[model samples]
Target: MKQPLIIIIRSINFSRVNKERNKRDIERNKRSKMVSSASSSEAKIISQCFVKPKTVSETSKDPYNLSPMDHVMLSFQYIQKGLLFLKPSDGAIKPQDFMETLLQKLKDSLATALVHFYLLSGRLSTSVTDDASSYSVFVDCNNSSGAGFIHAKSDLSVGDIVGSKYVPLVVQSFFDHHNEVKAKVTELVDGVFVGLSMNHSIGDGVSFWHFFNSLSEIFSSQETIDNNIKLFCLKNPPILRQVSTGSVYSLPFSESPKSNPQFQTQVLQERMLHFSSEAVRSLKSKANQESGTTTMISSLQSLTAFIWRSITRARKLQSDQETTCRFVADSRPRMVPPLPMNYFGVYISLVKTTAKVGNLLENEFGWAASKLHHVVVEHTGEKICSEMKRRFNPPCALPSETFYDPTIVHMGNSPRYDNYGCQFGMGKAVAVRSGNNDKYDGKVSAYPGREGGGSIDLEVCLLPEFMEALESDQEFMSPVSPSSG
Candidate 1:
């Protein structure tokens, strides 16, 4: 494959924030441990209840069908997204009243949004086939069941969160999901955090954000919602029609998104690494210049290679050891006839590239990047459909080894996910984070930088030693300071 270089680079020099940050981070890291270790006792759940749609559709009484893609997704856990927001600036409102209003508005708005996307209110269910050979899973739409909504609070302050070098493990408490979708709003001093956990079978990234955007719009819009269920976002209502894949299944009969994931045991650390636009441009320019292929090299492609290389180097593996880099692409546009952008389901294609540790570390940056570029471009419509069908037809999950391997690195989520715009009348979010349900060593999530433009934020999770090595690697640390984001 041929490509250019430089999209997002790795490493950060916190020198800009404080010349003494190295010493300060050490102290802060110790304090952070104390806070996370004890804060579980401080997280309080005030109330929990299912929020049904304010209105119901006649067809909603029927079971929501699952596509081949949704079936394969059943092997995975729930998709979790959490956003951090600055509390509305108006101080005139009493704290008690503010908390009361925020919770009520969000709950009410969520109910309203559920009316349009009623399938999400259903629970996962299973049924035996007539042949008695296998079973199928689907959404059992129930009028009484809807998205789970929770009201929570914590003693930890906003400063205990975004201000630190690593994300606090305490944030995971804000979300928990099974077969059903759920949302939680935790009131903290000076800021508010909202978390949403959804069944991966229910939808993909587009569907997930559509529901989020709907809730935010309803909450912020002054249009008073009546029992009639005022309609919003008329242009792009969700399309839940099942897409056939000509694939057979011997899937797990259980009907729910697994809250817990199985993985190797290790002391892990998570940090958000930011690559500013200038640094990204420089990396890309340098990478493309070296490869002599500017036209094919994309910022994202280049950035992925940069992250893969940096993390591989941190592992300090043998020269002949193999490393794998995997990422997913939306198959909506890759289908032969092309699925609608709003078509709701897990229409995705996975792209994997492998290389010898010696080759990747020895070659110029663009060589590793082109491997990713070539693999992704080769994933045509036919191949995507084939992969989706063959992925889970035999009723299996990716071996535990795929996630636990020290030489393996995987990236998920997308920078284009409009996460910062997922507001509930609280203005734009200042920072965004994910829950720990699916996290493991080498698990990485990508988000658009708060500063926007072409910058990127990589939420990385690794073993303590691996993370320490990554932070100390000057080769990857030379380009930028993550604090600017």
Candidate 2:
């Protein structure tokens, strides 16, 4: 494959001053441990309930056509996962009391949130046209479906999972389906762990966080006449504009006769690397220095560039080989009029940056960071709309094929999303994670840390050999501490 041209390049020397600065940042982030080690305590299922809306209007009973973006997402056929861990309240509340109160609040707030966001409670269905040859997939908002809620109890404490080397595998069982809201609340000796799994087809990360924030708002609001009345009034009501299907892209669907042949033969390892706020600052500073420009580098851009270089070096690809970095950018702000904050559907576009393996590995970190920044800056409102209009053209195949290519890296999620702010009456979460089973080699997930600082946690998956080399690479490991799973 032909590599994309480098848009910009500026060089600066790496000196002792940069090394000393990084060393100081690392020391500032170290803290003493306060929790016991992971125990053998297993979370036992207590109860399961289908949480339905309190009221479904007649207008809500009708099925709606899927937006053009939704149709595009239907091709992926994958569900996204999110897990949040909360410490116990600071009072003298009993475990039983806390569990009962938390479950009730969750159920009530979920029901209220579904009233405005009813599509989440619906199912994905396909209908044949009059010709019998054509079909369309849409959301059935008949209110016949509901989100799944599960309550469980665990003997482990909050410390066992938070900051632990590996996240507990029990977190995967929380959600039953992608469309359905699957939440598992495990009662710990001194805290509670909440896990949520959602279908990616329904909405992207922005929409997911909007719903979560609304749910938290409803839960935290005091019960009163005015508050109850305002609960149904949304700040930004969801508006489904008529999307032209002609502009939407369609991918060929081909079924492989061989079953699980390729996946069964491969080995992938998932690991979490925690980057402190100071570490991110250090990286941003180093990246800026390398650029030899006054242009400020974002934490995401700098870290991504650093990781991409580390991976390329670890994989040890040929100098002439081509490599690509892919990441998703939110399209709402890039749209002409800009979509509303509450516009709840897939509103994201993929960004792919490619370069020769030799150039990428031999260049200063600023070159990679500048390339990433250019990609983001190039996708303006007009450009994104134009791209959407031309979606029917042959889609780029590099990103989807990255999982099989050791030279390709795909980044997922963003630290811009305030995932840690998903408080449900309790204080902020101690930690948040993507489910264990959601990991894929050559893919990386990034999220804001729970420490309220500007830190980031990178959930990385790679082939065993590549991961081993990455862990030992001094430059990459300098600012990161790995959490093995």
Candidate 3:
């Protein structure tokens, strides 16, 4: 297997804006005694969610087996530089306070919760990771560089690269920045950009949203901060029992996308959009009442249907085969007493939905959206256990084999993304962006803004032809469905 190219630039030098940071250190030491030690706490969290694999065959499935280069799979990298919003008189900011608060937030965060158990064993044959321990979760802080800034990176696996990569994180940050904090911070060459590398086998864009939001919750709150915090409680982690056997599908990697002779290296686009959270919520409410669909399914369905219709219209192509959209489902409740929140591992499943292309181009957007909603709900059922087992089983010698399909489209969104309160002593973030491999050519993602009241920030990545068509339609550019508000 080929390894990914990774570049990491780190610097650590920080100056406090408030009173003597040493005074806060003393206070932190006092708090440390009150909190549990790192070794014991991390160990407890690990045990709460993971059990040692029963056999060697299971070990090979660990995503870690793919090598460290694989760690770079679905990565979205960004560099933020600027002065952040900091009111010295507002209150005293403490480092221990930030760490402790973040620790607690990780405990309840859906991302931490799902990762704890799923990453323990090995790679799951389907969704993301099958093993939890094989995964790595670590963050590097930079305070020494003369320029004050932060860098962030999010990784994806072979499956998600084909779909658009930049869409998820950009959308996530947009929603987070506009809806939750509403604080205009900073976006410069010296700002901060956080990075996370995980396999799509573990979770999808939605799962990423939940995890990021949990982190933001911790960063913004000074009251709930505590040094010694617990991240996961084992009240049925991994939710494996809830998974069914019928919906699983085999994805043979025999056939992959051929590199185009005309295309060279892929470069990503970076931009920031502002929206109010209030607008997003209102749209959700309307969609639920009128179409009887969950916010996740309804919004995504509309976006996918619109993109497909526009593309087909441009190509002058027509077909009866249903267009498909696939994403992921985090599975972390199958264990008794659940897993720890910060257990960094993979544990997620895939959910695929298909709708007829003709039905999607209908005049009534709601009607087309509802059809997509139904398709998503019907295909992602929890009755595919046998199917999952068969798909992941070790390969066998055969004259003929099935191949992976490149045409299958996958879409997802994380309303929680825009919520990461990335505030250092300086200010807030000015902008955030993301991108990925060719697999995500037509992928679309959504996220909330820290200040946007109800409207979510959206990102769409498509082939040049498809993108041109979408841009050609003014409605698609501002196409927030009535249900989405």
| Segments of candidate 2 deviating more than 4 angstroms | 1-44, 77-79, 87-91, 177-181, 222-231, 234-262, 292-296, 393-404, 436-438, 481-485
lDDT for model 2 comes to 0.63
Question: Per-residue alpha-carbon lDDT of model 2 for 88-151, expressed as tens digits?
Answer: 5476886568678778877877778778777666666666655554455656766344766777
TM-score, cand. 3: 0.47
Distance (Å) between predicted and true CA of 32, model 1?
Answer: 10
Per-model TM values vs. the true structure: 0.86, 0.81, 0.47
Give the clashing pairs for model 1: 4-288, 5-284, 5-287, 5-288, 6-283, 6-284
RMSD of each: 7.5, 10.9, 15.5
Candidate 1 wrongly placed segments (more than 4 Å): 1-42, 130-132, 177-180, 224-229, 233-235, 243-264, 394-404
Per-candidate Cα lDDT values, in order, are 0.70, 0.63, 0.34
Alpha carbon lDDT at 333, candidate 2 = 82
Q: Give the TM-score of candidate 1.
A: 0.86
